[model samples]
Target: MRALTYHGAKDLRIDTVPDPVIEQPDDIVLRVTATAICGSDLHIYRGKIPMVDDGDVLGHEFMGVVEEVGAGVRDIRKGDRVVVPFTISCGECFFCRLQQYACCETTNDGRGAILNRKAITPPAALFGYSGLYGGVPGGQAELVRVPKANVGPLVVPGSLGDEQVLFLSDILPTGYQAALNAEVGEGSTVAIFGAGPVGMMAAACCRMLGAERILMVDQYRYRLDFAVQAYGVEEINFEECDDPAELIIERTGYRGVDASIEAVGFEAKGSVTETVLTAAKLEGSSGKALRQCIAATRRGGMVSVAGVYAGFIHAFMFGDAFDKGLTFRMGQTHVQRYMVELLQFIEDGRLVPDAIISHRMKLADAPRGYEIFEEKQEDCRKVVLTP
Candidate 1:
């Protein structure tokens, strides 16, 4: 099978690898029909994510037809088309019982113990993320072994194409969860940083949930313009301003937005000090986006983060967040908890996840796809690959 593998920083390749088989009682072998290169994959591509070795299969947003099912798999069967959630969880765990699938305790293989030292339990294992998350072979290949099949793979109707349903595996649910955490609702005001795919999805969701004013911030003119055209959001080009938060606050009548979301994660553009600190290994992530979120949010409002951050930030503005009584909510998306409802949204035409796709290529062309996406070539927004 040919799949995309991580070689090193800015290196990805299509390699012929051994096919996967059923490895557990609840596992199913899927023949991947469609897969996508997520923005988070860039972390691994840039060698920022630790523990990813050479030839590690790399992708999380994928959907396919079940080619074979283990004896214990009940709800899903052979030939069923399904979208697999990135988070692999055992449905019987305490967190799973509470619908917090991302916190499932039984799936991490003790690799998460390192984070336990910091009083933060590592999240559930994710497909193709890294050894930190179980290092499961991802679905970027022609075939993939999907564990916890009964729990994580949501069956999709034949009426919807793979493009329409693939994002259920990750970003669509992630963006939806971000909006929910920020309490977006009728007449709400929101400021979202990052106009990438996830940011665009969040804007669409905020509008669907009845947000009257949505402010989108990013350095890319094309992305910001797309957000305005697609979701009717107000655009803020951070590159054009001295401080984007100050601009957001001033534009919002000095009250700031009701909710501020940071969709750009650890790799967000930062100041010289933050870059130096990160390069020196003193900071785990850039606090630039979070700082903007805090400074642009109204007092007692919510600051929701859907972005991925694996470590500590230097000079975090926790004091200001405390002083403002701002509520903070962030985490890996519990994709299983929201997949079914969001699928309904897609089926009803309330959410058009595929509308953001700007490029489509064969699985063999994934290296080029990654290059264009990372370099923002051809005004790329999202890239989908067919195996």
Candidate 2:
């Protein structure tokens, strides 16, 4: 089998690798049908997350047909079409009981390993991610071995194309969870940082949740313009505005946004200092978007973060959050909690997940797809690949 492998910073390749087989009784081998490259994957691609092994598979968002199932997997049978969540979880755990699948105690192997090596506690194992997770082979290949198969993979019964359900594995659920964390409701005004795929998806979700006005913030004209055109969202190009936070405040008559969301993870742009800090290994990420998110939220408002942070930030607005009584919610999305509802949304014609795709290619062209997405080339918003 040919799988996309991460060689090092800014280097990815298609390499021949052994096919996967069911290892655990609850595991299953999936013949991958479609996969999408996520923005989080860029963090590893640029070596921002350095714990990745050289031969690790390079994807997390995918859907496939079940080729084989372990003895314990009874609900899912061979030839079933399914979309697996990125987080591996045992549905019977305490966290799973609370619907917090991302924090399942039984799947913290990656967190324990990372704590042992770097003294940094990570979340549960993420597919195709670094050793910070379990180093589970990702879905960006011909076939993949899925753990916790009974609870992780959602069986898709519709005749819908893979693109419609592929995002259910990651970004769709991630964006929906991010919006849920913001607590947006009727007449609420929300400001979300980043016009990337996740940010826009959050906007769509907020709209569904009855937000009156949604502000889309980013420096990229292409992305913001797409968000505006696609989601009927208001645009806030940070480059055009002197101060995004202040502008948002002024537009809202000084009360500020009712909810603020940060969708830009680690590699936030717009600051030379943060860039230097990142390159020098002096800071975790730019954190500029988060700073703006804090500044844009009204007092007593909620600030939700869906963007991933691989390390600690040197500076955070703890004082501002404290003074404003802001409620902060962040974590890896408990994808299993929302996959079914999102699929229903798609089936009902209320959401069109595939509208965000800007590029499509074969699995072998994954390197080029990664380059195009990382560089924002050709107005790329998202890329979907097939084997």
Candidate 3:
């Protein structure tokens, strides 16, 4: 099988590897049809996440057909079209019962190593993610072994295209969760930092949930402009303003935005030197976007973070957030919990997830796809690869 593997910083290759076979009674082997690179994947690509090893398969956002199933996998079978959640979870756990699939206790085998390094318990195992989670082989290959088959793979009707249901694996629920965490509703004013795909979805979701006004902030004019045009949200290029928080203040008539979303994680627009230093293991990740989120959010506003940050963020304004009584919500999305409702949103003609896709290529061209996506070249917002 051909799949993209991580070699090092800024290096990925489509390598031929062994085909997958069923490993557990509840397991399924999926013939992956479509897979997409995620913004979080850049953390591994940049060597900032320290979770992957050389030759680890790279990819988490994908959908496929069930090629085979284990003996205990009764609800799933061969030829079933499904979108597998990136977070591999056993549905019978206590956390799973609470709809907290990301924190499932039984899924991750990498928690010891993760806690040894970070001093915090790890989340559920993630496909194609680094050893810091589970070192599970990702879905960006010809076939993948899927665990917890009964719980994680959400079956989609055959009529819906892969593009429509694929984002439901992660970013769709992530964006919707961001909005829900912010507690945005009718007549609420919101500001979002980072105009990437998750930010775009957050904007769209905010409007769908009845936000009265939406403001998008980003350093790139192209992204800001893209979000503005796509969602009818006001845009601000941070480079254009002396202080972006003041723009939020002025835009919301001095009250600040009612809520804010942090969609730029480790790749946040901060000092290039510091980001490089951090990536090189010289310092910590910068909290440039989080600072901006706190600065732009109104007093008592909710700050919802959908971005991926692994370690301590330097210069985080905890005091400011505390002083302002701001509510902060941050975590990986519990994807399966939100999939059904969000899938309905798409099936009802409310969302076109593929709008974020700017490039599509064969799985053999995955290396190039990663390059374009990581470099943000060719106005690329998203990249989808077919295997």
- Per-model TM values vs. the true structure: 0.98, 0.96, 0.95
- lDDT of every predicted structure (CA atoms): 0.92, 0.88, 0.86
In the order shown, what is each candidate's alpha-carbon RMSD?
A: 1.2, 1.9, 1.9
lDDT of 2 by residue, 205-233 (tens): 88888999998889899998888888888
Please say which candidate is ahead in TM-score: 1 or 2. 1
Residue-wise C-alpha lDDT for candidate 3, range 255-335, written one tens digit per residue = 899999998886666777667767676645678888888988989899998988755567787999998899999888899
Candidate 3 has what TM-score? 0.95
Query: How do these models rank on lDDT, best leading?
Result: 1, 2, 3
Please rank every candidate by TM-score, starting with the best.
Answer: 1, 2, 3
Off by over 4 Å in 2: 112-122
lDDT of 1 at 201: 88
For candidate 1, list the clashing residue pairs, or say none.
none
Cand. 2 Cα-lDDT: 0.88
Model 2 lowest lDDT segment of ten: 112-121
Whichever of 1 and 3 has more lDDT, that candidate is: 1
- Give Cα distance to truth, residue 320, candidate 1, Å: 1.0
